[model samples]
Target: MLRVCFTAEDLLRVRFADEPAPMVELMLAVATLQRSEAVFGLWRRRMGRALTRSAGPLLELVPATGKGPLFLDPPIPGFDAGLEHVLSTPTALVRSELHRVHARDRAPSPWTRLLADRDRDSWQNLEHALRTAHTHIVAAPWERIRAGFDAERAWRTHLLAGQGIHAMLTGLAPTARWRETTLEFDSTDDVEVSLDGTGITVLPSVYWTGRPLVGRYAQGWFLVYPAVTPLPDIDDPTSTDTLAMLLGRTRATILEQLLRPRTGSDLVRDLGLAKSSVSEHTKALRAARLITAQRDGKAIWHSCTPLGLELLACLPESRGKPA
Candidate 1:
């Protein structure tokens, strides 16, 4: 089990005192899970077969909100009525819009057939059915393993990891706002602590499992931070350095191809490299802050860092002049 420790000071920074620390943490966890599901669903629809490898890991890590009855008493602040209403209501509006857009088109994808059907109720039912059927058997085992290890310690580690992933995707700093109290884990491992914008000493622990699982679970939390700012312009010179660092590619051709967002598989196909190699290179790039990966269902989409574009523009053409 992963347990999170937050300092009093950290809690103050984020103004989280209004709600109890535990409650706030749970809410954040739920939100992050929700976002992951949404992103994953999108990817499953878009990429289809190519998503097999990453989809298993992602689905194993994050499961959907279950089929419990919608809460009517004091409802969840923004999402009071429930997910059905939340998804169904907007879907009706979107279906109409799509119909208009495709009115002149001769053909559309098989999946788009539903959009053309124009039955909001049927579509909504289908959506809910798909969500319900979507299962990640691995997630249950992993969660069981994590919980059995060190409940509170595991929770905190997963939380931080999720926040870190969120930071990369949205380009927002992953921060933990917590109270300053030092909570020791049951284990004897030295509780190494770190601080972020929040006034909390994030206690790192290794009580339950090894580092690999910790790293994998932590990613769920890392991708949870909100995207607070617009993505930086890719063409700016200063951004190129950042991109090169993130993607680990100095070649002009590779850099140029990454300008438009593409899936890891697409990149592998185009570059004639093995998928594993592409994944490794991308991970390194992500670690260096040179590129960002956005999860879409089962596949990860990659794009150049803003700094990468600047580097591309500065490179001299074959004719010996900058393009």
Candidate 2:
């Protein structure tokens, strides 16, 4: 089992990886597929319309570095020296035009900071944290509660107990400080933690969900500490074969699920199986290149690869009349 701490670095890596390819393509396509002036004109028009209609802030999100036009700090110092020359010249017209050029030429926008905020609030991350916590409970099998704990209550207890442990282990206060804490569960008996801490708790559950525990000191939300383990290295062929052998019925179920995109937890709940089993089967299918798995927070979703579909098409029906 992989012991993982939900850290900013880990979250950033996941964000970078999971950002849709289409968004990148759209940006590139706008520049290359259309005339440069036409592209700029369109952008300017859009900005003008938006500014005209909105009293709210106008914000543009820029990448820190790489393939797109240099918006943020350049890889090399003094790379943007020429920017002043262009913006200062008469060619730079409308204020929006200058803003666009500055955005394109200046250091990356502070939008990343805003993004960080949203990432902290994302539900997807919360789900991931919960799954991770459950896995930990299963692996270690915490003293089973005397009464049958519903998913929600179990999660709440786990979060509270885990928070206590997290404080002991990390020596850090909960990221989401709380004057009061409470827990909630989903329809499936899944758990959720709400906190009222001044800041969000960097606990496992929060890490998985990427949501900050939000609330005031006197009326704070619950804090959940999830048990997280390292994700096993699934790339090893031996690991793949072993997982595949163990999968049996799970293999068929996963294959069917991957005919379309499905999240890890979705598979586990739908199949009425343990998360470890789902994860193991997913690892095998992913290794075989029969399916592709992409991480969206704690949940890693899977889908059938073209190769997998082709292979499936070729399989002979066992009871077919034809040989």
Candidate 3:
């Protein structure tokens, strides 16, 4: 079990990230290789083929079964930076971290030579592998996945306000709970972390599975746990037949368009449908509580609600159909 002790000051400093960081996603993608959950099976197969031998050094960064060193957790403050951010990790820190993790392992470390001298070529290969994996595995579904992350953040913020911090902490995962001044995590290992007053940043990750992961870095200590909800596979075809029978072609098309939030003009341009027709369809969807429309200044933005997303998940993507 892992227990984190927090002071009153730490509670005041606790916060959630507004968006998911790319570096966090990249590291979690590497960790996903060890998992066999159904949600990740498709991603795992694709990554298996994409990961090259050049990225061999990165595999040693995280252990296959136990807790990985804090070095794997780059202390990035925000989600703004891209792959370049990770590639810029200080050379000294990298070398020191590599030795720390490898020193404890019984097997020969493939990265010892490079870490010892901070070899330029070795770092170059690692960068290439991470960029390639990000492009092939994470880029396509990022928008939809990001939407899920944003929704979960919103829900947690509301929980903190309505029910208090204790509820919000326990709500993070099934194994997580709060007792007096300390937070407890159910895991195989026994560990204790005291956050004197540094507090902690909680990140909700779509790729992280199983128990929560904890690490400390230059910025501060933080925990990355699986989000409460998983993004639905927009391509799943389980109930497409039923959805088509209930909602007609045009309305079904409209719901599919809203898979990612779009403004009125966006739907008009993409669908090549008249403004009035799109308005009518949107009105019906809103009445059914399937989709929601929020006016921002002059333009109206539309997006699928939880119910709308569920219905769309049941239906297949719209193929070539007449406007």
Candidate 4:
């Protein structure tokens, strides 16, 4: 069991992450991918089919059962910036973390030894692997991930408003319990932490479908737990090819991009199309009531309607139900 003793100050400092940190989410996905739990089987198989061996070096560092080095996932804002931070970890910290990982695993692999010794070539290979993995695993599903975060925030916010913090914390799961100022939950490690006014960030995870993860990080402490709500359309093999065949590639691409609100310029730049092409596609989309547009001064923002989202969620051959 993991128990966290919190002070009043710590309670005051408790909060939610506004946006899912890319590095943090990526690391969680990597760890979750290693799991053999039945709940994760479908997700793992799909991701495994999609991902290449480009992520091997990272996998070498983060074992399935043991905690990875904290430096691999600092509470940074941007994904690339976070990767840069991981690569630039202090030599002493790298050695210490790798040694800790080794202690838990009880084996001496060649990569671990070279990494512990601060080998420059090994570092380069690691950097390449991490970047390649991020491109494949996180890039495509990012918008859906962001949507999941938004849903989590809304759900938690409602809970906080209606019940209060104690109810919010203890209500995380059936087994989670609160002892006055302390919160306790099941964990692999039997650990206790006193949050000495350094309050923790409470996050709802989409990838980490396991027991609650409570640990101190570079920024501070984080209590990341699994979210009950699954991401809409994340599981479905996006029938983009079908959508493309129906809508034509450009229109289909524009429709997918409109999952989030975007301006004409945003579409043009993002899709690498001309301004006229975006305007033409959006006009057809709006005419069909597949999307809605709002005027924000000079810019007209376009977003997918429920019809559009439903269309994406349930298309022919999509594995999802038919619309």
Best by TM-score: 4
Candidate 2 per-residue lDDT over residues 177-196, each given as its tens digit? 22222222222213343222
Predicted structure with the largest lDDT when compared to the true one = 4
Question: TM-score of each candidate?
Answer: 0.24, 0.23, 0.67, 0.70
Q: Which stretches of candidate 3 lie over 4 Å from their true place?
A: 53-57, 65-69, 75-85, 103-108, 231-323
Model 1, span 1-323: residue lDDT tens: 12234344544432111111121122222223343333234433443343344332222222232111111011121222233343444445445544543443223444445544655664554444333322221121223322222322322333345554223222212222223343222222233343333442121111111110101111111111211111111123223232222222322334566789989888778888777767755654453344678999999888888644543544333112112
Cα-based lDDT for every prediction: 0.34, 0.33, 0.67, 0.73
lDDT of 3 by residue, 79-103 (tens): 3355555566677776766666667
Runs in model 4 deviating more than 4 A are 49-52, 230-323
Tens digit of lDDT per residue, candidate 4, span 1-323?
A: 88999999999998987777777777777887788855567878877766546676677777775268888877667788898899888989988888887788656579878877889998888888778778866777776676666655655665676668886787565468888898998777888999999998987766665677776777889887766433322322333344543344566678888889999999888778888767867875774456899999999999998767865665535222222
Error of 4 at 189 (Å): 1.7
- The order by descending lDDT is 4, 3, 1, 2
- In candidate 2, how many Å is residue 59 off? 66
Judge candidate 1 at residue 70 and give its lDDT. 16
Worst 10 residues of 2 by lDDT: 14-23
Inter-residue clash pairs, candidate 4: none
User: What is the Å distance of residue 298 in model 4 from its true position?
Assistant: 64
